[model samples]
Target: MFPEPNSELPEDPSAPEEAYLESPHHGFQGDRGAAPVQAAIPAALTIAVSREAGSRGSTIGARVGQKLGWQVYNQELLEYIAQEGTFRQELVENLTPGAGRWVEDRLQELLREQNLSQHPSIINLARLVLTLGAQGEVILIGRGAGCILPRASTLYVRIVAPLPDRVAYMSQWLRLTEEEAAEQVRLRDQRRANFLATHFHRPPGDVYQYDLLLNSSLLGEDLCAALIVQAARAKPGALRGKGL
Candidate 1:
């Protein structure tokens, strides 16, 4: 079994656009899109998924990857790094794909997020995400990928369900009592809200920002996966600048 992985924002209805969910992928260092990083437009398509508490986001993501025959990246970034040596070998060959300094330049920009430039883990994770976004044909879940990758080349999907359904799902999945499940769900939802606020400065569960917003309870994992696959296939993701 895989371990579970880990934004707030208020919306102004009168505003034309939400600066919180901007195109620039400033990510964890600060508010989403608040900082600018220069990079080229990505030509390949990538899918970024943000899911509701107690939802089958990880399952749906893996199903989508299977259907699309693409690699699914979820949970802690370190798990993939430590467990898959083959991945490490492959990363070297794909580091610099073209004339653009997208990978290197993007890495530097990502450093400004937390101002922890010397932090190896943070640097490694940022580099991995930027590179993955560049490579395309990948599905990334959580870790603020929605805010970290370019909007043009990534298909952002949000999965949600009613509170009651989520409570039930959590209770069953985690083998907890109903009350315990409810508390767990609340804790999770609040954490996500905080994360969005900290990183993206957007309201909790900002459905409008995503390209496709799904109710996993209604669509089910397979159907949700199918829909995401359809949307991703409909358009090829592209990176526009010389830089992720």
Candidate 2:
């Protein structure tokens, strides 16, 4: 999926007289124009899935990836960060779910340090996502990828379920009581919303950010996946390269 590499340009004739006298090279050769660069068509589908806790978002993303023969990048992105940052993968994974608030605050504080020479790790994550997107396709779960790559021809889907349904699902999934599950969901949602607002300066619940917002409670996962596949397939000139 890389863009065509540019050819070397002809030597400039506007050099200073002393430099021209010192140099052995003189007149330029005829132009050896190379063929126009063509971008390769991506073989896999790139999807970004965002959902509240206990919405079965990961499960649905996994199924979609399997159907399309694409790799799922949900928590695997943390592994990438761990490798790049020289941190423990498990530590990064543990810091992912509702850990955005702590990470954002810590990174913000780090940015304020005058001695800091490099961008925060969060910026590194954005670069990694963009690079991976250029190299074929993968399903990215959470981490605000929708906001990060808003211009790409990405299938941005947000999954939402009724509060009661989400609570019930979380109770079973997390082995927690109904009351505890409800509280956990509430806190996690609030944490995610705050994190997005702090970093992206936009509301997390904004419907305009997503191309498709599916209510998992109303539509089954299979139906939702089918609809997404159909919609993506029907879109014209989506996979064409606009620019590198």
Candidate 3:
């Protein structure tokens, strides 16, 4: 019972030029003129995909959103979150949930200057994620969304594979040498894991939070998305949207 794509996302007039930088999928244009419109999203289905480095979590999230005709938010979420002018670019780019890096400290300063009700970057991000989730038909990739949202309102998926397999996948997909790929994988995994553990107190790979966990190396991206779609449909209160 997948529905048509609700491609109309709220616009941020104050979004900086950097915010509109060409994300991986730039050709598919969406409405940029509308003020923030919050749709009625009761029974709206949201998917939060958290993955180990090189697990192709973002790729799978894209495929699932495309097939289901929903909006997939990845790098764009960063832009959306920062549009309110509370988060500085350097801070937003470098802030992590883990130990206070210099950038994180700067972000805290900016938050204080803005006098935002939500001071922590993690809290602000969680607010944005929940807002988008309430609008429904969204697939949020990374930024610790699965841990922040209510388990009842969202489908949390974790993607993982053997270290060697993930490293190899990154090498092939990104055209990096195996050694380079391995380093990228290691760093990214640590960063994500630390972000989650530090802010949410939840380990990235904790099995308890997920509705489904898949090994991307075994299932591949397409099959992994297919399985998630099937599972989402089977979940009680089936994801029925505006125009199925």
TM-score of each: 0.69, 0.66, 0.65
After superposition, candidate 3 runs with Cα above 4 Å error: 1-43, 83-119, 238-244
Regions of model 1 farther than 4 Å from truth: 1-43, 77-93, 97-100, 107-121, 237-244
Root-mean-square deviation per candidate: 22.8, 12.8, 21.3
**Model number with the top TM-score:** 1
Q: Per-residue CA lDDT of candidate 1, range 53-151, in tens?
A: 888898899999999999998866534662455785467466555513575676666555643234454455555677777778899988667766767
Model 3: lDDT equals 0.72
Predicted model with the maximum lDDT: 1
**Candidate 3 structure quality by residue, lDDT tens digits, 47-148:** 889899888888999999988999898956644764565543443344233222322343355346542235355556755665565556788899877765
In candidate 2, what are the lDDT values of residues 145-238, reduced to their tens digit?
Answer: 6665533446788989899999999999999999999999999899878766765566778899887888888897888777766655644355
TM-score of 1: 0.69
Model 2 local distance difference test score: 0.66
Whichever of 1 and 3 has more lDDT, that candidate is 1
